[model samples]
Target chain A: NAGVTQTPKFRILKIGQSMTLQCTQDMNHNYMYWYRQDPGMGLKLIYYSVGAGITDKGEVPNGYNVSRSTTEDFPLRLELAAPSQTSVYFCASSWGMNTEAFFGQGTRLTVV
Target chain B: GIQVEQSPPDLILQEGANSTLRCNFSDSVNNLQWFHQNPWGQLINLFYIPSGTKQNGRLSATTVATERYSLLYISSSQTTDSGVYFCAVEMAGSGGSNYKLTFGKGTLLTVNP
Candidate 1:
């Protein structure tokens, strides 16, 4: 099984540029999350969706937005990317509450 | 919001040695999970122990909800086990389907062969 898949394993973005980090899962999980990991820091939640059309902000959601259009896809969008936005982005999904989460390989993003 | 802390921040152990990693959370939680992030940056789920204990091969985990702490034990460590171990938790009152996991800074483990 593919589990969770993230596109553009690596990317370089110019300041003020906008891009979308694509994430998909074949596990049919209902809960999806977007998190970013900075150097020497733990993963911080940026956004999460309980199900299709239901999205919520997480601990660090400033420069990003997420949309869950279907059960399998949860894409994160960054507008006006800044140097502070550079980090490794991870996408995760779970079947329900109190369940194990499966994470993608992650996208290493660099904002210049 | 809940805070999760893990220690020691770094550990080095020789192959065949055993080690224990600890995770402490500030508030009551409904669930706790342990993950191993390899050099390639893939978060591999190690355990989903909300309370009590569970084991898988050479790795085991225990979580005491009342005490708000969890422990991950690795037996007979190997070079392949070198990575960053993270502890994540979800607060108890996170009602509805929106479940968010708060993660600790992680404990970096280096198993020398």
Candidate 2:
């Protein structure tokens, strides 16, 4: 079974362009998160959802938006891409609080 | 939010050698995890030891919640083990609403043959 699946494994966007990073999980997890990892920097949380229709901002939520209309999907939207936003984005999910998280392969996005 | 720190920042070991990685947190936490990001940039879950100890083959991990620290032990290191090790934690929050994980800068490891 595919634990966590992320689409657009790689992408390039010009400044001010917009795109969405799609994430899906087959494991009926209740908690889903979006994180971005930059060079020499640790993964920074962007947004997370406790469950369907329940979303919350994380450490870095600017320039991004998320929606969880269904338990199986949590998509991250980039309204205005910037060079600073060019980083590897990862999608993760867990059964619930205090559980091990499963991460997707990650999407490599480069904004010019 | 909790603060996570990992050391010794960098490590180099020869094949068949053993090494230990450490992670320290600034506050109490309800969840802690260790991850290995390979050169290919794929993150692989190493351990999910919030408390006590867990072992898997050549790797093991221990978490002392009361001390706000954890240790990861790798035995008989191999070239495949070269990667960046990261420690992440989720602070203990009321009603479990605050579940965001804070990660350390990470410890870069290189295993030479």
Please tell me which predicted candidate would have the highest TM-score against the true structure: 2
Model 1 chain A: ten consecutive residues of lowest lDDT: A94-103
TM-score of chain A of each: 0.99, 0.99
Q: How far does residue A73 in candidate 2 sit from its true spot (Å)?
A: 0.3
TM-score of each: 0.97, 0.97
Error of 1 at A75 (Å): 0.6
Q: Model 2 clash pairs?
A: none
Docking class of 1: medium
Highest-DockQ candidate:
2
Cα lDDT tens digits, model 2, A9-94, are: 99999999999999999999999999999998899999999999999988899999999999999999999899999999999999
Model 1 C-alpha lDDT per residue in residues A1-112, reported as the tens digit of each score: 9999999999999999999999999999999999999998899989988899999888789999999999999999999999999999999999987788889999999999
The residue-by-residue lDDT of candidate 2 on B14-105, one tens digit each, is: 99999999999999998999999999988899999899999999999999999999999999999999999999998887543367778899
